[model samples]
Target: MLHVAPSPAVAGNRHRRQMLLPWLDAEGQRRIRESTVLISRVGGLGGPLAQSLAVAGVGRIVLFHEGALLDEDLHRMVLMHPERVGEPRGSQAAETLRRLGGPHLEVHGFDHRITEDEATRWMREADIAVGAAPTYEERLLLNDAALAAGKPFVDAAMYDDETHVLCVDAGKSGCLRCLVPEPPPWRADFPVLAAVSAMVGNLAASLALRILAGAGPIPWGELVHFDAARIELTRVRVPRSAGCPACAAAERTSR
Candidate 1:
């Protein structure tokens, strides 16, 4: 329930606190309301994550996906309509995000995978980034972007009924490069299920928003694994890897 501007809306400030009344103070909410985040692949995980962020009053959101909708993807890609089976996914998600956000929400839709150049370009404008892509190549790109930008990046993943989340708050929290020293090969489609997708995606948004609002310290350098089927929820600590490839370049640059 974001309040619309009374009249002239000021730049760098708008109706950002209208929806964050539940857990965020006006100041925290305003910080989020003024920040921007770039989310890759608005598919299964990214769709819900983006929806939650938009609904939570994020000031701006940019999403990228380089594919057309397919029938099989609809089970997880909630923002797409059955009729939009052949339309571009990024375009569809951009429209849906606009509807979910208040008038001040800025939306950028890119129908292409993120490259180093493009990633750096968007990363400069965004405060944080979310990696919901199914492929590790894309995830690696995001990790590099996060490392390059010195910003928070949430690595989200799911397998069957299990979901895992890792937050990377630069300089303070460990990054993806620090946790997984090597990028794992991706399956054509990852082991994602509806239940786990929702859990992981929502958790990603919650964690990202908490960081964005400066509400609490994020679970950086730590991993949270939840499996409802086995009734197992645990946190594992991962130390910074000495030979992480994606981030090694940056570590050397700073020295």
Candidate 2:
């Protein structure tokens, strides 16, 4: 549920441009204002994702990323600056988001990875969950938590020169586990370019907003892939695996 207040007058002045859109009038903008999004790992993809959602006027954003900023992260992590290279990424990101998001938007940052116990609480509280972690282990954890809490999960990833954006609508869509039951055998670290990550991050945010506001024809269980080298975009529908542990369990319980 969105944390919306029944205000007679909409704050159209702040988001006038968005309000002007035919689908997103005062009511739609208000929906965005009342929504809460939980974004995990505010590094390459998470950085721009948080920024885009803030600009879109999402009511609240809760970010999770544990570690200090690295010099290398400056290239892709938009929330990071060279001056804060050694500072905590979560705190730095939260502070930056608060400033960029203005006073109306609520921002919370956790400097440690969300525990299994904490995952459900945060997922249930938020209207949406985004997985932007660099490792498949972390991404899988987020998927489990989001599914358990009955929240939609948006995943964005960039590898080499290719990027993938996917959204899992819990029971209705194929989840991360459904797509990849096991983590890839390759090492976690990979080559990344800021330009590519930022572009994919913005697309992920756009999909999230569409799902949240019910404004556009969201992909739902589809995967949106981008190949920067070839400059091509592809959409592929992903089907749910009947044997998927996480989603399969949910299905059995519901029936």
Candidate 3:
């Protein structure tokens, strides 16, 4: 059911030509071309992640982000333009992706954040969900939606020079709620570097591509941490919390 369309010829497409590696062959590329990914926020982290997916041939992207662009957001929002300031961030991001991905890629841009009431409806249209919101509330909402829809979820976040990426495969892996049972205190104006945000976003994109293409075993439930300060990358398994209300409720429903 994931591969909804027939595989298109990849012969002369320059964007996908370079991606033809042993790990991701023509069939893999076709899979990528048919997948629809939902991104929670098209800001710092989500900007690069959506751009990478667009260029890599994702068939569609659903973007959700509230508010108009501010001058301060340009430092890390790669898809946003200075001229587009005061414009809706979601629509601007969608326009940028459409320009990059050409006519084949479809993008639905919402000028508001995904609400609890709308989560299930949106999740039904996506094959996977990626969360890059600054707030734990949004990330956890996305996690619950993805789990309920039986879709993979990737949680990407960064603070200053440090980055964190978590890939969850619904019932098979721990959800975001498992790692943070209660919402942690976080600031909306978190400090971040452009380069570090892009690095983590691209990393999350790569993980997403692997999952979409079925290239290899997914690192589900693993927390990938990158410390730009020390130039270190670490991976640790996140054990599923037995008391996680989000995933636990999902597990019970599956039975």
lDDT of each: 0.77, 0.83, 0.85
Best by lDDT: 3
Compared with the true structure, the alpha-carbon lDDT of candidate 1 equals 0.77
Put down candidate 2 lDDT per residue, 1-255, tens digits, no spaces.
Answer: 113222244344677877777777767777888899988888888899889998888888888899889998888889876797888888888877876777677778888887677777887788888999888888888888888777788999999889998898877789889988999988857899988888899999988887778788778888899999999999888899988887865465346
* Best-first order by lDDT: 3, 2, 1
What TM-score would each prediction reach against the true structure?
0.87, 0.92, 0.92
Residues forming the 10-long window of minimal summed lDDT in candidate 1: 1-10
Question: How many clashing pairs per prediction, in order?
Answer: 1, 0, 0
Per-residue C-alpha lDDT of model 3 across residues 158-247, encoded as one tens digit per residue: 998899999997777877888887789756678888899999999999999989998876779999999999999998898888877777
- Point out where model 3 deviates above 4 Å: 1-11, 252-255
TM match of model 1 to true structure: 0.87
Query: Over the stretch 94-117, how does candidate 1's per-residue lDDT look in tens digits?
Result: 888877775767788887787778
Higher-scoring candidate on lDDT, 1 or 3: 3
